[model samples]
Target chain A: MASTDTFTDIRGCPSGARPLHRPRRRVPREPPASSFPTRSGDFGTGARTRTGTGARLRNPAERARRQWAVSGWAGLSVVCRPGVGGMAQSRGMTSIKATSGGESAVRVRGLVKHYGSTKALDGVDLDVRQGTVLGVLGPNGAGKTTLVRVLSTLVQPDAGTAMVAGYDVLTQPRQLRRVIGLTGQYASVDEKLSGRENLYMIGRLLDLSRKDARRRAEEMLERFSLTEAAKRPAAQYSGGMRRRLDLAASMVGHPAVLYLDEPTTGLDPRTRNEVWREVRRMVGDGSTVLLTTQYMEEAEQLADELTVVDRGRVIAEGRVDELKARIGGRTLRIRPTDGHRPAEMAEALAASPVTGVGGATADVEDGTVTVPIVDDDQLTAVVRLLAERGFGIAEIGTSLPSLDEVFLAVTGQKASVPQDPRPAADNSDDLEGAAV
Target chain B: MSTATITPPAAVRGARSEGRIGLRANLRHISALVRRNALQIKQDPESMFDALLMPIIFTLLFVYVFGGAISGKGHQAAYVNYVVPGLMAMMGMNIAQAVGTGINDDFKKGVMDRFRTMPIARSSVLIAKIVVEIGRMLVATAILLGMGFALGMTVHTDVLHLLAAVVLSLVFGASLMWIFILLGLTMKTAQSVQGVAMLVLMPLQFGSSIFAPTTTMPGWLQSFTDVNPLSNLADASRALVNGGAVAHSVWMTLAWAIGITAVTAPLAVMRFRKKA
Candidate 1:
């Protein structure tokens, strides 16, 4: 369970300060960020500060300092003094430092975003420790994209606050922008520009010198294995190549925090694995990544933490194994060849808690009986009972709890794509007429 | 790894020099947009052919067909002098749809969304679109002006006057970009921009004194035409080409141009930010 203190802190109303004589003050706790149940291995290691309101009122710089101190992961010291003259130099950025020293790369408190009347993000709070991958798993329209947008500075939040890379998102957006890279779901490259030109354009946008932009563009083309096709216009590029180029273009400035919003939505397994390898490479180089995915196996494979969001709120969060363990029971499958009786097969599977009793002769194409046992120990009993019934078994296996089942269990909706308001034609004639 | 411990002086200096490079990046983005527009022109020359060809065709057809009735000049005579300036002003106004339609297409195609995530300057995308508009305007000007010259339209003004006229036309052309940018943000469809912008611009061209002198129009229409920026622009262009006195209308035309740009630029930018 999430801490009561974290929830109260997010409310900004001190729990103990409520007046007994006054009317009831209704304060809604901010929704926790989409993430899995975090292990308590390091929670109390950090301090949460409360700066004085007077200090916040004096100077904007002091206010940023207060927010930073209040919000930043505890062990690191971040000082903000007035005067633009020495501010950049005083940050001590002589050499690039890894963000892994007991500091959260991202922190949000009571962040809320509303699109008209629809609350896209219903007050999201998050803490991402440095250099780890936090995968946001949610069905479509679960506010994953909205959360990423706010943290990335693409969208403004209605309420609450967030800090990225020790910079307050609202107060220090320009600085925050420099330290983060965002790759949205759609390809953003200019179709008229060549792949090389597209990367070069982004490099230029990130403030690289002309020579450096060219150099970076060349490097990215090679890194994404797009060097051969670099001179061709992006309009002619394949879907997978375009996605690779899009990801490559986002890396022009070597941002510290990378946000990949449903990065592999339209990719094939091989191409998806290629993107996964690049993400792994980035994380290996000490870049903190926030990825939103609908793929369960993807979260299990790459994420250090998983957060499941449903209907704009986080329903469950934790490491993948912890989520799997919480599913409580595993289903065991039994395949018996030429079963003596269907009753014997049903009885074997019904020995444990008996949550369900199901078997089908057609479950095995070759005239055999199959049953599902929902307990680990029940599997042995099934084997013994089958032998006692003088029935030979063909094969048996256990199916572990899957993320699909978890999603259905939590959201009460089968994981499927929501119907978009706009419908595009099939374009069968165009597809057939296009050059391969 | 090779055991070379030496660091080049360039490398050492480069590491220490922390100069601001955002301006250069923005300049590069603008140049890239120009190149991209050039490539688009290359791929679909027919699409841009209309911007250049339409103005010339309109000059030829309108001058030959309507110049005799409107200005009492025969088609074979000096009708080119009467219609060329109008054609030039109309060319700028005609290409306003290209900016709005192109921007609307880009918005619909998710191009703007893509640009938002890019490390480039946020203003550069719109700036690039405006730069492309300037090119289209110049192309249209060249085509119409060349057609007029080919048809024995003599310039009584000196080279300086001609240059000033061209510069004024281009300034007016650039100012026209803000309205299109704002329209592009307001309208969801590229085709709707064509339908709506034409409805607004066609009257501004025909209802004004572009085709004929304001003296030829009715009294109520003449007053409206006098205040029309298009009329002032056409009058200014005519005075420059005819080597007449630098008219008071040039100042009014410039004022309108500056005023529209001032009001619309901020609104366009704000709308763009909201859309993104």
Candidate 2:
């Protein structure tokens, strides 16, 4: 049966196709109290209740739209509103697009897969709206790659369902494969073929005409800045170049949805930024992206909404700012003068009326005393109390919690580098060794 | 880069129908994959070393080492005509084994994942590998025929008969590949695929009539050779080129080809689908 159930255009075009240079339209904002549920109900109650409601909806598209509406509104109201923070204001434009009720490009619910005795994906649920990136953040062996593999139809899930771009991953894999592109964790380019040949081969396999395939190959090679090495074998290319080629190969078909499984895992900062730029450009061109990464910076730089997964389950899901905010608002870091000890300062701050009754705890680490402050009043009160106590502050600053801190708060464990027993033989040794 | 100016083609933008790949598109996909595998061989010429060298070494060793012993003192030239056609069967079996190793190596690399995720028909990948290996087998047969001629062996029948003999070997060779392809898909690594293939190939190669006539063998061994597909292939090619009663052996070889393919092709596809 020809099912168009998942076919919803982001631009609201009835035909599901849009012109290349059409003027961009502002996302239609839904009222906070109408379509969206309470923010705390969606994110604060943990992954189980949220996933339970999502699973109860029989239609995956309906479930995806509902979940997207909830998370999208939460992300927008928390980050896009004016006067929130300089960081949120700077990112407000992207979050606005993220909040649109665009069709879900990928809808996965109650996904479960087991490899032998280990559960690779334990009842995971995710939704990615058109023209936005949903970052699946997890540590190694956290089922990130398995989720990507299952959604891309490379691996079948043991149970549950996934629908991508109007095609069910299990029943309609061929149709799903037509609209989705996957750049796996390992670069999947043909090593023996030249860069140009690799792209051309993929173009042809994607059902492009021979002339179009050749033209698309040239266009992708030029776009990725691989024209200089177009004729060289991919095996001879550097790690970054091979990754670019793999990305280019996946893009030759201009798939409506792209899955990037750790696209910049071992890349240097320069290459990582290049990948991020490519991802943004694709999103700007009206393609939905589901990016899986272990790097917080990568997720922060690309994902409009983040889904934190660990040990085969979704631990937390929201905007990056919301996740950080959930841990607790900005932290007040105080470094006392060289003569005073941070431990004594922390003890005094903890005992003071300003911080004691509010339940904001103060802790000392590496010569700095940090207090989690909920508002500007707490910040001012702490500063006044410190001055009244005759404390000499050498350095003081208020900073938002890093993703590392948020990860620790949620997973209750640091996102440590996974213990890979193999030597770093795959790529450039510079950043890979540092990453390990 | 400004991808804003670049849009996907109209075919991609439109509502994609739930269409199965037609025969024409499947043929195109198979040809494209075949070109890819052929290009790999072109880039790494050493991959074809066995196909080129094995026939030459085997032809010389069998002709000189066992010619007089097997065919009697003054009849070495007769043995040349006898063993050369039989060696064609051997060439087919050896070249077919490479298909399994090549597929296992692709599985080890990330390229297999790419193939699996593409919208093309899954059988296209295996068919392309078989096509390229069959091409390699033809090349080895040509080299074996040339070596046989250089060693003073002559074809008694017309070139049509000699060509038929070569085609028969390839038909049998292509069918044998599905078995090895199954081994490649099920085995963990290329080394293990080779190890298991060798274990299966040794007895089949020795017990068959590819090296000597089955008439001189023990009764029980002859009974085994009566049913061995390799022996049927060797006997068929011997009759086709040396001008003998060709109907029985030729029909038996074709039947074995159909039977092996019928059993193994579906099994290989099932294994390929479940491999990940």
Candidate 3:
């Protein structure tokens, strides 16, 4: 049965085929006063299964375990729920209370930021709960990093209200700083200091007693697997090690809210997984993480609820799976036997309930015909229909929607590796010792 | 979990004392920074060698080589006496670059950013750097005086003149430091700070009377050198060391220090805030 609850673009744009690709360029109206808060809230509002690469539907048992994990933590309140289904027309602030009664980790109302004449955040209102990870997924120039910087108190917004851990960003920034940690795209660790000393220095600044600071430093050193090299200066460490140390340093304060801006922009797959594990560990310990990344796989694997921002405005947001489901549940694929047989394969596949007739002969050169299947059962019916029509089918496959597809569909843009050029080192030593 | 929830008088006192924690925290940070840099220097004494050795070498070179040529006919004026004071002032100015380089190194290493994100006193980082520089300038001064005495550069004045000359030179050194500190903060690249400092210091020193009397220069150059801060500092220092009249140059030296401080301090603070 087709659910009429399916959201269609009000302007009659086709769903699941053509994505709402036009860039949102206008400034949004002001959010309502009720939505403003002095700071952000806690995390862990909800959870579900962690999908593995194996071709299996979500198991009932896994869902129950996830539900348990989400609820067992002490409850923290969510300030606002993301507007569902349709595009947000008004800039009105929406007050949302989390499942837990605790204060929100972040509260923002009509937070608009601009760079010169170009607007980076066109009046965005976001309420991230405490102890949970909120993954910010966006195409290039989506203002994800800008929003993170503003909330982290590194950059000031041109207009609107924001609070982190209950401290006003503008008025009570110093107090707010005590309760948060920020990691930038590049590692912000001091390469000259030993890994242990870096953590200890941060701990000392956070008002930890000497004994407590040393203890915390030791704990972090072991946690990030740097204990063996903790005494060695960070300059000798590898790129991944430095990145890990940067994240570990931010955790020295045990900040209530952590802002990670593209934490893994340049890392090998193995290192990326290690970082993902570390993030999970942090969330499990009840720390709220707000991370921005260009890697869709990272977002799909880690985000509890993802927000897709484009050109400074939120275009879509939902649980990762739900978002994928909205943009066509599955894709059916097939291959033809010969390089020139695309027309023959398209004819046979089109007869078997496929929606579109599109492909080059080279796509079918491997003897394949691909189709988008709504249900797995359709695969069996398609194969039988192909056989009945005396069409030779060499290969067929079905796959779920990917983050890249969702990104392309929603923003009408393909995902590319993010460009973040590190500045070149210059020679000269007069005051050279002054720069770090 | 609470039994009658009563507040203690001691708790109130503790809360009151907490207000001063910010100051204490900053002091702690300053001490930590100084200790860290000092330890680095202790482990590698070669870094401090330049400060101690460079002044002595330059003083000798100036007194013997250029001193006689500028003193001219040498009938009355002692060239060694004339060169000592100017060399002492020049030594202080040269050592001031050490302060800028120290701060610049910390900034380039991401140490300053780490400090910024911390809850430590905001101004303590720069203050610690200045403290380190003052200590370095003292060492340089000692080397310079030792070399000058060996070269027959005698001071005709008493202890007060020696003390005042050293103090004035240190003040002038600090004034130069303020200008460079501003440079270090404004120029993001360490190389840029080095380039700009060399560009300013070399010309200023060359144009001053550290190596020769400004009266010996050409018409336009003489007037420019006469008003130069370096010349004023050298002349005042020479008067103090030789027991000569403490003329208007003394006030001029003090005025230059005060003037530069007044203008550069605010600009430095602004740049520091912007970068932070």
By TM-score, who's the top model here? 2
Residue-level lDDT tens digits of model 2 in B89-179: 9899988998998888888878888888888889999999999999999999999999999988888888999999999999999999999
Per-residue CA lDDT of candidate 1, range A147-197, in tens?
888887778888999998787777766566667877767536777778998
DockQ of each: 0.18, 0.37, 0.14
List interface RMSDs for the candidates, in order: 9.4, 2.8, 8.8
User: Which regions in candidate 1 have their CA more than 4 angstroms from the true location?
Assistant: A1-102, A330-399, A414-436, B1-25, B73-76
- How well is each residue in B162-264 modelled by candidate 3, as lDDT tens digits? 8788888888888888888888887767787888888988878889988777776899998889889989888898889888777788899999999998998
RMSD of model 2, in Å? 11.6
Candidate 3, residues A150-263, lDDT tens digits: the string is 876667888999988677888766666666777875327766668887787776666666777788888888888999999887878887888889889988876678888887
Docking class of 3: incorrect
Q: What stretches of model 2 exceed 4 Å from their correct place?
A: A1-100, A332-371, A376-398, A414-436, B1-16
DockQ agreement of candidate 1 with the native complex: 0.18
- Can you give the TM-score per candidate against the true fold? 0.73, 0.79, 0.71
CA lDDT of each candidate? 0.64, 0.74, 0.63
Q: Residue-wise lDDT of candidate 1 within B118-137, one digit each (tens)?
A: 54566778888888878888
